[model samples]
Target: MSSATHRTAEEIGRTATGPRPVPPLGEQRFAADLSHVDTELSNGLRVLAVRKATVPLVELRVWIPFAGTDVLHPATAEVLAETLLTGTARRDRIAVDTELALIGGDLGAGVDPERLILNGTTLASGLPTMLDVLGDVFTGASYADAEVARERERLIERIAVSRTQPRTIAREALQKQRYGDHPAVREVPRAEDVAVVEPEQVRALHTASVLPRGSVLVIVGDIDPETIIGDLEKALGGWASDATAARLPALPELSGGNVLLVPRSGAVQSQLRLSAQTVPRTHPRYAAVQMANLVFGGYFSSRLVENIREDKGYTYSAHSGFEFTDQNAVVNIDADTANDATAAALLETRYELGRLGMVPPTAEEVESVRQYAIGSLVTATSSQTGLAGQLTALAATGLGPEWLAEHPARLAEVTAEEVAQAALDYFAPKRFSGVVVGDAELLAPKLTALGDVTVGAPAE
Candidate 1:
């Protein structure tokens, strides 16, 4: 190397230190101006529009309370979502796709037990076309027999393939254990039912429940909120029905008792799934509990990950998160380990759960997690699509951009004492009950001794 370049490199390396202390965050709060328009149509359809001039595009989200408690509803609703936009009376499937492509737009719909979610995106100028297309589908979906038949066969094939997947198996088993005899347990419809679902059944389901009344629509883009809401009213004026939207009954609380072992014969790895009842998002203690969750297992540096993955090298990954559906909220924790290491991994996980509650977080730990929480929230809503999705979720719980803008303060205001109490009440290991899906012969021996052990097929 030249002498001059060598000397420059040496000078740069001299300043690279062993450790650099991170400066404390200044006493400045980051606030977002999330001004938006919220209105309801005469038919009870709610609309939330936010003007964001950052991009020449628009994101659309539609959420309908599509709950049905009957045994056939899950399979039928799945079929309905798959074919919702295949064709309308005014346009065929090919025509719909062609128009959307011409406008640089795309749309998709899916169903869970609690909601039917329709998500779409389009160029800013195509907002009218997007709404028109949505209106056509909402009011005039043909539910053609040929399309339904094809999608039904495809869905059956997909279900058959997914049933054997390890994650799907674990999730199904855990849901059943958590909500016995509840509709939530029927997330995946029975394969036999899917195979037999007729187009008539799907058409009937749509006619009965897929109405605009009691539904929510969130639009975010580089557009005028006032003009857009007016446009939405005009576009969806005809998309009305007398039938009220379907809604789920009050969800039963999760009952925690013993660990249920679901036998996946000859499996080399086991999935550890745990769940406990938690309060809904609107609960007064939710912010503190949310912080406590992060310190425990909600983030990479959480105690659960530090103990089970980083320290002991049991599992490669682990996570804990909340699932909110209407009035229900559930805390779900998941980790996967080798069949032989299953029991040990679970033991360490439970230990960390108990430790987080009993000992609580240190002041430094609370500050670190609180900063992480606030930062994550800011990052989540910084983009148009991100903000639209967050607002859409909040809309379901009777919240809007006001709540979105105010949640950062909520996280910041969570005290260390509140976080500790939340941990003690909610993060205790005994409050969680779940299923361990692994080889019965291998796991049953140790898991039987670990807690209550029951052996059965993946479905049982």
Candidate 2:
């Protein structure tokens, strides 16, 4: 090798002896001009329009609150969502697909305990056609017996397969442990119930719960906000309802105590799911709480992952996050570990939770996660689809675009002291209730030795 090249290589190696200081993150180069039109129609359906001329495409999201007290609501709603776009009064199944294809549009619907959502995308010029199709499905769905039967069978098969998953078992067990027999625990309905859901019942559910009165439609992309609302009025004016939108029963506050065990016979690994009651996004301390969570387990660099995965090699991945409903919110932590490492991983998890409260995060730790949080928020909403989905979900909880605009500032202003306080309040080990799902023979002793163990059937 030449002397100059060798010397240059040696200099680069010498420069790497100590850790390089990361450049400070610059101020946000662009404050999102989240200007939009938000309004309510005469029939009470709310419309939100955001204009982003980056691409000549439009994204649509519809949220209809469908909470019900009936145990069968979830099953019936699942079938309804699956078959919603299959056929309408004026268009048969094939015709519907063909028509949407002609306009370069596609749409789908899904259901959960709280809402039925319709999400779609189309060319910018096809917005009116998409809205018209949406109106057709909303007002004139046929819920044909053939389509319902097909979708229902498919849903049953999917649910049966999903039930065999460790994560699903753990989640259902945790919900039941937290909420008892509350209907809110029915995130996934019984497979048997879905099999028996008749077409007439699905149509009835569509008639009863799919109301425009309290629903929201979010449209984003290259479009004029003023012009789109008018188009929506012309398209969806026929879909009206006088009945009030259904509301879920208040979510019981999450309380932490003994751990529950769900026996998954002969399982190779355990899925540990933990949750703690938390405040809604509107809470003043939410920003601090979010940052504290990030430092605890919200990211790959979090203390929980650093201890249990990076340091100990317990599991492939672990995560902590928040789930928000209309007026309730909770923090969820999940990790899947080998049967042999389950106890050790759980012990480390508990240690990190406790340490975050008692020892608190150092300024460096807090600042690292704070930057991640701020950067994540900006990147998450920088896309049209991301912003549209976010805005629609927020609307269901009575929040709007203003909340999105102000949240970055709130996160930026959170202090290290405040994050520490939030950690102390919410990250106490005793404040988490969860379920460990694994083989009974392999995990029973280790889990029982860890804490209390309850052997019970997972909620149907």
Candidate 3:
């Protein structure tokens, strides 16, 4: 072809009718009617098994409430999660790995102040073997002395590095500022604490905290929900418990006040973390709040991003989203800004927040957010792993697949008036309080000049 005959890329994208008419989005679809079983095994572990035959694979998620008030609980829990799959009575560390590998499976565990989570995947046909391994770990894991020692040392080193991270510093300050002495504030255990955690303590903590009565297991894959329940019963039959898992103490309701400015002596950048209490997923008003959140700062095109990130260039990223814990929920807004832009970033963030409620989202804004919300939900649950994750989270709060299936309709039904009302009720500037972490000398003057900001560190 001659060079002259080759059309440019832009010309190829255009037509005689001018720019092509963008095709309208197809009708939004809700989640399929999943074949599922939501029932409690005799041992008291709630089992939620759903059949989504998208592929010949299975995804598993287990959630167990693991809160504690013991001073060394966090460190012990951390070590326990690392060593949980190291060995059971019937299998040692290498043996456990070999068995899982034979079945194309792998399992891992992690713990936080709120819960201990174990998630994994395997070939669908290997579900029975996977259940067997989980059962062994739950019922009879021997937190071997060597394994405990190794992981504890590694955890101590990791904690040392983590505590120095800006995000970690900001998070700890924010938690303390918000929750005071609540155990939930103790997210990262102290390095000193991990150093002193013994194998005996890890074993004791596992025996007491890793129970079944109040925990939930979610499995999604290409299997029969009805028969899978029987398989689970057979596999985890002996892993019984009379006591429920420990639940974290309820957090005090948050009321907006001052934003604490925590000094990080030489930091060149600042992390602005703001939070406000809000309704949980099961709340009737959550759909409206969800849309309101997207319009404010939940997505790339939100008002906050448009103002501080795109226009003013104060931040490269700014985000707002909800964090759910058991039955409680709160919205968190965060941005990392250069030291010079820190105070201005906070000011613009609050400005957008106030604007969201006062001006509210227009019909077009409402529709855009609504579509985004529904589309995100659908995309998130389209696969087995995604569905399993969604179910595990919902099951922790006593919900099931039915709730997931109906959420799209709920979002679609949310009106512009409702979203605006949610904005006013939830996104008011006065309804938020948080921490700004940076050099006190650099940020103190401008941040203090802005009212409702206090200088100094959060209380220990």
Candidate 4:
């Protein structure tokens, strides 16, 4: 009722009743003995296994390389992965999902940067039944034309919606600009391409990528790894090559720098995206670059947040990350800001980039970032679903299932000097390529004055 009364209530609420934990200063250490990263296989299927006794749940991600990048049909492998769970020989979509619901089981598959993931989680006792059902889908799914068409239409609809999101649209635009001549530049699959895919095409794609030209299975949880591998060996041993021809798409080389701005008239906000080629996971600089990114934008407490949000209140979010694929490496920077402040925000980000390389982090900053990163790794295996995704994806990338085990040590070895070096090498503003999605006509002039800018075609 009174200003003094309101102030008193607010102050009381702000006072801590107990000693709550302060979030660690930097990326923290991950713990949980990562000693045994058991790897082996039966038949042609690769098996990566990790044991986590903390929970009764088991997570399985059975990946098939058949999402057919090998066959030159992007997204078909993903479409196939999705369709398999839609139905099986013994059940339709409704029956399949219903079966999962009744048992408190969660089962699904998806396509990520490098693999088509078939993943699920359930109690240890349910492993056998769960595996059997998954086997049926993986081995004998009915990829009905009608289903594929339905999925195709759905993706097309999603693309239309994606166009309206400035951040998503800008990222895609940046990809195109950076990879002007490379296929790795294909961000979202073209909607028109989906209309041309039939059930036969989907099957062909699956036969090549998902059917094990290069595939692996990862299991983590309560089960015995050897026993599970034995069973898988027997179940999958008979399967042979689909004999589908596969080839790698040449990765795109970075074109001389370019900036693209897409206009959205009368808009309040602008989305900024920056991308450049990056080092692979196994590169010597990988750890250092990764650590630098964490300090810059990879974490909530990084320089991006410190400047963009904490210091200026320009945006609630601004961050960066890198994703490595079999064919290429990519680093991405994203942020949203008012149209009027968009170019100014870009200028500030550029300065932060310079500082990341030129400045040495305080000891406090280094420890805090380490704490956040490592601690998150420890609990990763706690979730059966997450563990499954990690293992399967790692296997797909030619990394062993035990990859998670090495993360803490690898990250721990990264030094402040290395991080600064990585920043200096990889985060150069001159190498930066970007897309600004806003009212481009009005926004373009503001940006061109800030840096080299080219306005892209207005969205349809």
Candidate 5:
């Protein structure tokens, strides 16, 4: 084992034939058809159940439209979600916990500007017990005063800290800039607002907002699809209402404009966020647009990452992807960079955007991203939890498992020319507007000089 007897690392990696050629991808496999039932219960809840039988566990996802226009809606909604599973008339917090623990099950609730989501997991044998517990909460949850007081204080403290984070500040600024006064801009409630939220207010909000008419429930795991529907009907039978769940108003379409510069005095780093409107999943050109996105910055090997992160070292991470709302979708590009590199990073990002349209991705690039799109879809849906989540998202927009099963073929049929056309049509630099969070005095001169940038007041 002398040093001289062993080859160096470089020599070991190379051969006399000069490095190896990358193997071509094999034939892509499509997802198999799953036995599922999609129907509506008497209580007005749409239920989708699939039999995966991969394990003894069942994954549950419930999505309810929870939009509101009251001034205190966000604060009241936050408190409601915090205490939703804390108690019911038949079970207190500990009793609820014990019942679920005995059956290897757990349930939680969360809310945002658009929806209230409840996620749960349980042994397949415990499915009926889980449904009964869910029904108990839906029908008679007593939001105790003590529980409300304690959770409200904790939420206030967390909000105080979250509002101070750089990313949070940038997100708020971007939302305001892009959507103006849309209710979707109200993501985080104010601490003062939470402090004033009384327990009765939380209870009233729960009774008024958490309806079943406009909601969907998705279940995937070891079970019979047909029999499970009857079981769901029996369990959620009494939780009915004549009113439909509230839905958020449609967001105004985004158009290209100047980037806003929000000052964060003495910051050592900066946040770069950019967005533009795009086609929804149901659109005919969605497949092509998806491929174009992957080639731009949706994955690690994208052109934007190669330019800024690997070659220039301007940032540690950079990404571009789509965000879907109701029936609309928008593409977002984001990167965090050192203060010194902010201006140059912005320049390069715009440069790549312009170049993408002028010089589109080649056939090889299209093929690489195409395989990635299909492979990722198949891989993501291969599990019970993953498939449930995918179906839930699709269900939110009036789609079902059928759309998920047919997506791979759509990606396969997208041509390189179609991808190129999507790139030119959607990724143009002029079609984006966003905000940069940094020290304005330092970033202003250079950013303003870059054109299409305006400086705003310092962040409070």
Candidate 6:
């Protein structure tokens, strides 16, 4: 009796408990309010400059709103922008690299769902030389057919490799489901598609789409604004002022209440995508929905993460959030746990979804996330580079800084009822698509109760 009454130190330590340290989060605010810089060139090219004088580096982001959505120009001009730096009108790829090293500079271009941007970085002192290369790539590009073929071959390899990556496959698969096989959702130009793009197509697309009429150039560095903008005008002053308005293609409506299973063999974990049409940046409920997502799965302490990943250890990480697009969009969750735990994990997801429109967040939870979310906003868009990145994205969808500034108030004003309402309105757990990659034979039997399973074989 005496021995039992004396609690061992080991037992005490094992049961030890104290207040859990709260996680870090961001608050709401405008990051770039300190100063703003933008100028339009004589060529009708808009130039935006930000002087982060503290740093010796400067970043340039040039925007052209010709994404793959345009059937006439599906990544033709964008791809050429990439290989342009690889080989110059004056030299080959090797020579360009050699010259770039002399000043520690490089260039690349990317096509997004809504914009085609040419982005690069260089030291502040290296701006003069970098500008020359920028002009050479854009105005004086010599698109030899040989380089186009080479890049197309590499694109095929990339597409092939993407099929094997589970998360990547799930993401692409989800986009395909949400947006259909439309060019907007279709990022990988197939081998056949690549073959159709001739050097002439690249050249023609460049002349037609990559011009100053609707372009915005962002220069971030330690430089004099007046001087830099002056230099930029000289280079672009003679550029074609003809602006060809490119209209965004209409996006398909996001419908709910369905399950799509892409089954794979040798599976250990399952990937899930829950989709719904959401309000655009201009919607009144945008903030409320953002707050709702915060309480749902935007953070680690979020309900989905806390329940499925941390508490249950169903997966390493489980989270969900909305992706804003020109049209209504989808919310997705990705995770990989043991095949056996798939059902339990999904059940938890369903339960959490149900809870959102039910209990709603307490004031404490709302305020905590509000501070974190808003603070997070400032840090996320603090850099000049970050600011410029957002401009083109907003510009593509007919939204801008004016729309973003009102976001905090909208978020702060949201209540638990609104979030619960949003959950009821947007989240569709029953019809969510689940794509599992890995041993399907072993995984499918465990997921029998979830829904009918479709086995997916590799694309030959």
Q: Say which candidate scores most in lDDT.
A: 5
Give model 5's TM-score versus the native structure.
0.96
- Better candidate by TM-score, 1 or 6: 1
lDDT of every predicted structure (CA atoms): 0.87, 0.86, 0.91, 0.69, 0.91, 0.68
Candidate 4, poorest ten consecutive residues by summed lDDT: 27-36
The clash count for each model shown is 0, 0, 0, 21, 0, 17
Give the better candidate number (4 or 5) by TM-score.
5
> Candidate 6's residue-wise lDDT over 159-201, tens digit each?
6686577777666666766677666765544545655677888
The residue pairs found clashing in candidate 2 are: none
What would the per-residue lDDT of candidate 2 be over residues 1-460, giving only the tens digit for each residue?
9865666544554555664555666776322465588899878988888887788988899899889888788899999999999999898889888878988999999988888999999988777778888889989999999999999999999999998777777888888888888777888888999988999999899889899998888888998888778888889999998996787788899878777877787788889888999988999999999999999999999999889889899999999999998899999999999999988888888889999999989999888987898788778777888888788878988888888778878987988899999999998999998888887778777777777556666333
CA deviation > 4 Å runs, candidate 1 = 1-18, 23-32, 456-460
Tens-place lDDT digits, model 1, residues 240-326: 888889878777787676888898878999999999999877888999999999999999999999988999888999999998888
Which is the better candidate, 2 or 5, if ranked by lDDT? 5
Q: On residues 99-138, what C-alpha lDDT tens digit does candidate 4 reach at each position?
A: 7766567887766434566668877877776776776676
Ranking by TM-score: 5, 3, 2, 1, 4, 6
* Candidate 3 lDDT by residue in tens digits, 1-460: 9998999978887899897553544675444477888899998999998889889999999999999999999989999999999998899999999989999998999999999999999998787899999999999999999999998888988998998889998899988889999999999999998999898998889888899889999999998999998898899889886788999989888998789999888889999999999999999999999999999999999999999999999999999999888777999999999999999999998999889989989998999888788788888898888888888888978999999888888988999999999999999999999999998998999999999999975323
- What pairs collide in candidate 1? none
Ranking by lDDT: 5, 3, 1, 2, 4, 6
TM-score attained by model 1:
0.94
Q: Give stretches of model 4 more than 4 Å off.
A: 1-42, 66-72, 75-79, 112-114, 242-250, 253-256
**Candidate 3 Cα deviation (angstroms), residue 62:** 0.7
The local distance difference test score of model 5 is 0.91
lDDT of 5 by residue, 336-365 (tens): 999889999999999999999999999989
lDDT of 2 at 412: 78
